[model samples]
Target: MRDEKWTARIEAGVEGLTKAEWAPDSRNILCFSEWGLRVTIWSLSTGTATYIQFPKHPDRGYAFRKDGRYFVLAERYKSKDMMGVYDCPSGYKLIRHFALPTTSLASISLSPTGNHVAAWEAASEFKVVIMNLTGQHIATFIPTDDPLLGVRHILWHPSGTYLLVGGWDSKLYILSSLEWKVVATIQLASRLPSSTACCTIHSS
Candidate 1:
């Protein structure tokens, strides 16, 4: 589905775009804009759109639960740090928000069960931090090399035991949740001629 093109509109204009995930049951596409400020949930079947506005003018990051009951969103504002859970059927109301130690949020991913969240912050270097649903820090998954690669685009495996990450480095890393180690690294050929790549693990 990565190669297929869909239509979406931004504040500036409309254009063809690719999405991270499509809700099979609801026909909604979950995607963030290039700037990451606005997250749009679009209905492919009906051509309807819903826009969720962030409290602070920070970059937007989103994740969807397996059951599609709830989703998580993280925003980075200049003075106030924000993170919240939103009921999918309704609009974003505010589950939690806090003052962040830093000013930048690199990315955000939610576990398959919707019980935990993983977020990345930018400092001298990037750092991956995990938090529970109540807005409490649980642990940090620091990569051996640059954390930017793994945290840039993260997706929770179906089993919730691993995280799949890919980005500009052209390498996909499968990170183990138990030891927080990179168990497998898959590199794409330089001549693939694709701007982005994503993965989905199927069960037997």
Candidate 2:
């Protein structure tokens, strides 16, 4: 008794939706549910959905790559934090799982070139971690304390040469990817609110 004209809908007897997005390729729809414990990739042409499982619940720090080839998720397993890269074409199969040094489980971002990844730590204020796809720790940046506390967000430059880290401290930290160090810091007149942040990029 259902109409075929409807685009698509999740089948009954499943968990509710947490988040959804269209794959960059536009041919498929990616859905996350159970707080990242379950993923379903729905095909528009074939009208079928494939389910994928995660080892742990991915709270919020997760995003698919630009090319739709992969996705990065900061997952919580056994009370520990982990970073996972899953292959997009293979029903979201796990490709790599990197154990994070901290337990913040904050936001994560991938470099434009797909070579590096960065994560913000909330448990420890003003700490950012940089790493590669091979589970090797590249560098950790812990800047001087300010009124702004934990890192709120992380963004990578299009050139993949630098990163921008923002925090509650009312400042932005520009980090060099190559040198793995803070090259400059921009301070504001006021402390950034705990729930608010700023991010910008300009090439000179």
Candidate 3:
């Protein structure tokens, strides 16, 4: 702070509050209510507040664009998985609201380019659904058919050319962006297999 003589007080809309965060721009604050009820955004510059209800998770259900121009939040509305995108600079205006084709959305991630969003099905299902800005379905992918497979997290590469998915089954799936195909799979294990042997590398 330029001067240590400035102070402002902000309060949550409800009594039982949980997670409180600052928007990327540092001009606004996001407060998540207890029991997944709602999120209140309090603006420091304008001294105003905005509320969004049914936040999927207090810590990980929302993401903001790198530049803070946009915000994507996952919500549960009417017993269905819904997503809302907000325009940050314009006072968190609702730019788009749409339903997702998922049973229980675990988490969501916005591509670095801000062109698409990826949502994954929660435990007991291994599904990742990608969608464009207009709410059109792009593709849904299941890395494995094992009944125990479940998606734990999903993220996009900084270049926005690849997507990385982590699973409860202990594996990582890399998907190419344009074609939306699994480019590689990285498996995690406690030890090497019996058939696997040590190898040597030679440089000439």
> RMSD for each model, in Å, please?
10.7, 7.8, 6.4
Q: Encode model 1's per-residue lDDT on 47-94: one tens digit a residue.
A: 767765553323345666667767677665555557767676654345
Q: Which structure is stronger by lDDT: 1 or 3?
A: 3
The CA root-mean-square deviation of candidate 3, after full C-alpha superposition on the true structure, stands at 6.4
Where model 3 places Cα greater than 4 Å from the true spot, the runs are: 1-4, 191-204
Which residue pairs show backbone clashes in model 3?
none
As for TM-score, the candidate ahead, 1 or 2, is 2
Candidate number of the best TM-score: 3
- Candidate 2 per-residue lDDT, tens place, 146-187, comes to 444788678888999989987777688898887888899998
Q: lDDT of model 1 at residue 139?
A: 68
Clashes of each: 1, 2, 0
Residue 193 C-alpha lDDT in model 1: 37
**Residue pairs that clash (backbone atoms under 3 angstroms), model 2:** 148-168, 148-169
1-204, model 3: which lDDT tens digit per residue? 585776787665555788888889888989898888988899888888898889888888688987789899999999999999899888889999999999788888899998889998878888899998678999998865564868877878999999998898888889999799998988889567757848655799
Screening candidate 1 with a backbone cut-off below 3 angstroms (N, C-alpha, C), the clashing residue pairs are: 36-60
lDDT of 1 at 159: 78
Worst 10 residues of 1 by lDDT: 10-19
lDDT for model 3: 0.86
